[model samples]
Target: MKEQLNSLVLKYQQTNDEKVFKEIYKLSVAKFHPTFNAIAKSLRASVDEVFALYEDVLLRCIPTYTGEGNFENYFMFSVKNKRANLYRDRKLRTQKEVLECCLPKDDDTSAATLEIISEETPEDTLVRKKRADQRQLIRSLLDQTDETTINIVEAFLSCERPTPTAIGKTLGIHHMTVIRKLEKLARNFDSKQFGDFRDYLIAN
Candidate 1:
């Protein structure tokens, strides 16, 4: 696979043919479709989004493909890095939306009031610290879980309209299993803290 991909890349570079580039794209998807699906599931992204990223990576990396090292590894590494970046950007957007909702609207509040609201109060600091501690606790619990369970939890929290059936289908598990695992996981956290943990997981 490595040698073949490298040869195709070399050919594309030599001729700069659109047809050759299309063949490269086709071969890449055929080889890496499973990887694309895995990344999409992990990030709660659609398959199309993952394919779009894959296409972008191919375009960006092909120009620099020196054929010095393993092309497959290089391509996959780029894909994984881009997936991480997409996850980070999504998290940032979620956090921003949450923060925006918490802030007073400009139309309803004066500039002085908005300024006051922007400043963190002592109580707000305390609340933030407590939430951080809760998140740490949740993270520890998650660390104890198996990879499948963690993936389940992430899918549950990140999906826009999450349901046990949908999550199970996405993860190739049964709906009943999804419910059971979720319930078992929820029991690990205190009833009051669970809400904060959910919010923390969703935002982070």
Candidate 2:
């Protein structure tokens, strides 16, 4: 592996051919697709988003390759770190959206009323209440599940964004078992309770 990576690196360095870069990029994608795809599945991101991130990570890693140690391992590490950052950024964006939803409207021109509702506008209050209700419904659904199912579901929903495969490894179960658990979770929640995210685990 080391020799192959070194050869690729030297070829790119000496010839300065973009084709070498392209070849290396393809190799990287093929080798690390599983790792990156798992991260995406864990985060419940679309396949397109994960592939886009994989490409970005590959491009960034290629320019900085030192050809030391295991190139595949180093490359996978970089991709995983990038995925982690993407997850964090996504979570932050979601939080920001929720906060923005809670803010007073531009034309909320009632001074005394504003004083009474200084923290949040009526619209914001309603949005938050709705979110709270949804959360409660989800919690109720989860409560009906067994311990293993609960653990599997929580792991899927974690910030770490562990894939079903990763969760299976952690729980000493088969990857297919993890997938089945997720399907069961989807079945547990009604479409109305889950809204458009009804089959979230399976969809991801």
For TM-score, the strongest prediction is 1
lDDT per residue for candidate 1 within 86-151, as digits (tens), equals 888777655554222245566566342222125565756876776566557666778767787788
lDDT of each: 0.66, 0.61
Candidate 2 C-alpha lDDT tens digits along 1-204: 656765675577557565676566557775666675676778767655776566545544554677677666777898779778778877865565532224445757633232222355566676566656655665677877778877776665552445555677788886556645655565566666555432243222
Clashes of each: 0, 0
